[model samples]
Target: MSTSATEPEAADLVCQLDNVQGMVDALTSVRWKRHQDAVVELSEHGIVLIVEESRCLQAKVYLQRELFVRYGYSAQGRPRFGVSLGLFVDCLNTFSVPGHSSTIEIQYPGPDMQLLLKSLDSANACIYAEIRTRIPDMVSWDYNFEPAGSTPLSFTVKSSALKEAIDDLEWPGSSIQITLQPVPPSVTFRGDGHGNLQIDFKYYVNTDLLVAFHCDHQVSYRYKYKFLHATTSNIPASVIKDNRGSKLTIGRGGMLKVQHLVSVARPSISHSHVDSAGYQQPSRIAYIEFFVKPEEDEATGNDS
Candidate 1:
């Protein structure tokens, strides 16, 4: 087949990242349900991977353009495609090697495009895999969470503290209640089941636990513990070590939003470059966010 000069090539649309495992880990951190497929949207800014569960919750893993050493897209408009999340994660996992650093390159040609992944490690080891792609579904969950506009009761808590509190609680509960007020016990968690358990969050004199707390009116809402526990249960160890906190917001009618800032790429000397002063520049800081929605229930009508 003959190709024209103005035509786009199969390798024209490509994105290369220095740390493939970092991106993989971020996506897998929020992988609670095994959906058959996921949607990948490509644009000038970056790439976004969307995963949903039973139409109740949605998680997005974003890899911004700055995270990539090289990112290119020749399409006139944004391009989106769907691929098997399981297969995709498996392909990335094939390149996993202990004590080795790897880079990944992804290429998308055109219609009937196949997703290609190439990984190269410091040990000169190379791994490549190609998976098929399909047109994404027309229906997708919209995650337009605007806390500024909405009158939501929001607060921030250290991820480690929250994880520990949830772990210590007795499980097998049907629902979990979150109560926020403008007084002491600013935040409260109640698990209703065979045994009642309550974990309260208040300003301590010697500790910096709650970073921020804001509430207009005292509100209490119940959510499926299973759904709310997904994020806390599967928290990445690195997130806990880094002490990255999570911002939780509860809107009217029991809508819950959990947001986390995950460090995707760590600053390293190898990734740095020499500056004019002959000193190595610091590596770039890259991060991705995880958004989780909990299945909300009717108000419990309890103020205290």
Candidate 2:
């Protein structure tokens, strides 16, 4: 297909963000695998970074267009390319200094199609880095989490509390078994090797911690500690500052989805945009989600 005249050429795509470090910090949170490359997708709306580990776990960091001071994409459709995440992150941190903030401008000039990063500091110091890009693999996995349908268990908890609870657990085991029931001891975290921890959210006792819970049938499943630990480790510091929590959904197939809301920008309360359908548009909120696949075993435990 011929390129449209209105479409952004590969070289004309550029994105500029006010807080470079914030972006860097968010990406670093999900840097679990050491040598994995990330696929970068650019569009008029914003940019998305996808990092996958062994096809067992996938983490996505989304930066909305409103978060950027200036964003442009001239491609007919979304443009996707691959680059070493570690290398890209290192380049971003090269200009980092204590108590200093830098504006970041990323450009993709045509021809060579190298990813160019230009960092400008308040003191007028400019640092430029050009990294090569590669054709992203077409066969990328997608996370299709259906919270509306037949999920056996779903709940929301404070990010800090979850982090602390996970950290407090013993790591002697390779897998951690999670048990959720309707009665007391609503949630239980059991280490396969040594420790047994139970967190109860009795209605008369502590209801605040358990934001929402819906589980008609009690369920128990086992997931790798290393994969689950990565979720807590990669939570952006900003998410903690905003006092955000995470939502977890466990499907019948032993698939777990963790969602964390990351505040991007403050909304203008006075004015709100209305779509063509006359629905009021809400404020922009970006979320980072992790999809984890559970190990298959005949001893999936009793949901009874």
Instruction: Give the alpha carbon lDDT tens digit for every residue of 51-167 in model 1.
Output: 766676666677778778888776667778888887788778777665555677777753347777667454566677768888997467776665532356788888889888777
TM-score of 2: 0.81
Error of 1 at 238 (Å): 1.3
What C-alpha lDDT values do all the predictions have? Answer: 0.67, 0.71
Q: Can you list the residue pairs that collide in candidate 1?
A: none
* Model 1 TM-score, all chains together: 0.81
- Tell me how many clashing residue pairs each candidate has: 0, 5
**What's the CA RMSD for each of the models?**
5.4, 6.3
- Most lDDT-accurate candidate: 2
